[model samples]
Target: MDTGLVGDRRWQEKIFTGEWRDGGGGVLPVIEPATGAELGVAGKAAPDDVARSVARADEAQAAWAAAPFSERAGVLRRAAELWTEHSAEVRTWLVREAGSVRRKAMRELGGTVAECWEAAALPSHPLGEVLPSERATLSMTRRTPVGVVGVIAPFNLPLKLAFRSVAPALALGNAVVLKPDPRTPVSGGVALARVFEEAGLPPGVLHVLPGGADVGAALVVQPAVRAVSFTGSSRAGHAVAELCARHSTRVHLELGGNSALIVMPDADLDRAVAAASYGAFYHQGQGCIVVGRHLVHDSVYDTYAQMLAEKAAGLTVGNPAEQDVALGPLIDAHQRDSVDALVTGSVEAGAKPLTGGTYQGLFYRPTVLADTGPGAPAYDAEVFGPVASVTRFSTADEAVELASDSPYGLALSILTADVTAGLEMAAAIPTGLAHINDQTIADDAHAPFGGLGESGNASRFGGPAANIEAYTDTRWITVHSAIPSY
Candidate 1:
């Protein structure tokens, strides 16, 4: 992957079957944060444009609903195959647009494409069950697709986020209207659209419009859209939730998180250092589930803190296109400043920077800090950059309380050599997903993935139950004998 400007004028000539030109003519410039160089431009969609996409999706959904489930699954499988073929190119695009480092971008591209293939196989086994009847004739239950789904993807891992809704929705025969983040829209829209085209999907089944907040607002409020699946910040998630409330549409939010990670006294100090480094630096800590708050047991606090600081210092922070670079720039300058403010505020509140509290361009130094009370901003805030705040807990109960104390319960990790201690802490934490002996970053597509409480809007985790549930709805069927008519 080479860090360079992305995008060509050809997108103007491109359309996903029936997708129209962006109505507002709002064009967002894609810039390389590191160099301040122009990458290219993407068309932004407004309220009317969102409505247009939704209308088209509604039209397609009717016909798609009638398509064989196997046929829908086959299309998704083929898209996954195409994704694999273009995996290298897609990684390059991600590094340029999403500011992902070469190695990390490759991993993201691979896993996200696999998510689609996994989603495709679901329809081959549409959920169904039977109930034996003694007095009644018969009873059965099955699943049905919802109407059109509105998906709003975030700037980081743009395609991966969009695919979350696109893969499952199409597999269950629902059309989608995707509103990708303005900063990084080209590859997600172009790549996925091409795959759908090659898969021989019909017109209007998949529509994509790119824009800022206004575009997102339009997509969620459309009357024809049955649901919304959003991935972004908490404040933005709230707005989407409110918009959907107007139309009574179901909304699935994978929103903001300030996750907690607890390291016990007996844990492997080196393993702890590596996990913390990856947790904070991977994607520059932009992911909602990354472990941003680290609580170490008092005994090993010094040893672990020293190791973490050294490791963070050793990380390479530069252009994401460089294969050796371990850390990439934050999405933009505004984001870099936001993380800076959080770190500065923490220091003002009486925290010590064990190492790393600097920035160069958009790249934040992998920062580690020793902090004070649990009420500190560093403890609970979503510091979406390569920054981690470390603190000490006296006991297992204290660690659990500190970890669960946050308002956001997106994800968590507990490190300990004692089996009983780790399990107890895991059981006590308030997060949606808790990891033992590992970082919170690892999640299987087949397992449920989501945050709890403020991190998400009423949607459940993604797994066998959740995946089929997301793409379909329960329907009951009953039968009665004519003998009863007598």
Candidate 2:
């Protein structure tokens, strides 16, 4: 069957144990949000397929773990090289399948390459520590790979997010069974398999199963799957964590976030506005760490709100493939409608719409809401779209309180010229990441990236140091040079 789709044909196959196969779960149509068109169809993995994938990963884990670190690192380096070499193709896939604007697509591709290279270097870095023993013996701790890992990646930034966990898991000598979001199976899942295979990765060391929630559930509960790394919404994260808990499997979750950006009176208006614009609307505010709340000091509240309104109105929204388009369409109609409902509910609750609160089809206007009080859904709930809700505060304490009021503590930004105030605010907020004089959405390959509370499960990802803790198990050993007389 043609599957009634358009775009790349390579995406039609499922990557099973090692080779492409027709999925037993049937076909899933990939829709492009930009024009509401069918981008392609992907072979979906069934529950049995997921189980087979886990078995293959478990079988491969032993040999891969026993392989020398240098050998494994070499393959990762090759994969990184291939990712960079095929950057153009990867970018196209992201734009068409993920509804990523040109710049966002480029950023994701670049980040994927960087993450792979970073993971490749993990073998050369210190993975363990030497400890002083109470007895006359040398004591040290060694980090060893966990067996098989189930990686459930999200649709937004699918390739980058998947690589965030997959590369590190592979670098640490763990076999991974990845289940990418069905909507982005080709760009997110299949492309990654191709990269690893071309880079000489051992067959069965990595498996890509493109499917929906059922496949993810199956992967999470398999006896051989010792750990799981998932990135998605809080509701889904909770479910996955609960499932893993039942099986006594370790799971790392990077879930939903309702971060805030606080603008103090001492902050430069231009810088604050720029920070708010980038933090709140970049990638159309679909990021987990995107600033959902904008808290402004009453002294500068009017000016900041006006400036932000103008900025939101000025942003261009159109086809994601267009170079100049600043905002792209939502992933699908469901998400678009959800965003609309949140905005509508907030407006009805007395939150004033400052600018751009409407939408046509999947492309929602960059929206800004002022006077959004505590009772309004937009004030506390995560919109997960191109929307920013502003609330004015009377004092520094009030600004901090408002920003820290949310149940989520993912990423927070405080814009102020006063270093002391910035430091004070950072100390007060309980988010995983905090920025002063910068946007909240920035991430580095060498930094610990994850969240707190509902945003994450207190587990860290990214960087060699953090991944060493996440993907490996620690064992303490002591050796005696001479026999002790008792």
- Prediction-by-prediction clash tally: 3, 0
Error of 2 at 390 (Å): 0.6
Q: Which residues of candidate 2, in runs, are more than 4 Å off?
A: 1-11, 481-486
State which candidate has the highest lDDT: 2
TM-score of each: 0.94, 0.96
lDDT of 2: 0.87
All candidates' lDDT scores? 0.78, 0.87
Give the C-alpha lDDT of model 1. Answer: 0.78
lDDT at position 429, candidate 2: 88
lDDT tens per residue, model 2, 163-182: 99999999989999999998
Each candidate: RMSD to true structure?
2.5, 2.6
For candidate 2, list the clashing residue pairs, or say none: none
Model 1, stretches more than 4 Å misplaced?
Answer: 1-9, 13-22, 457-461, 483-486
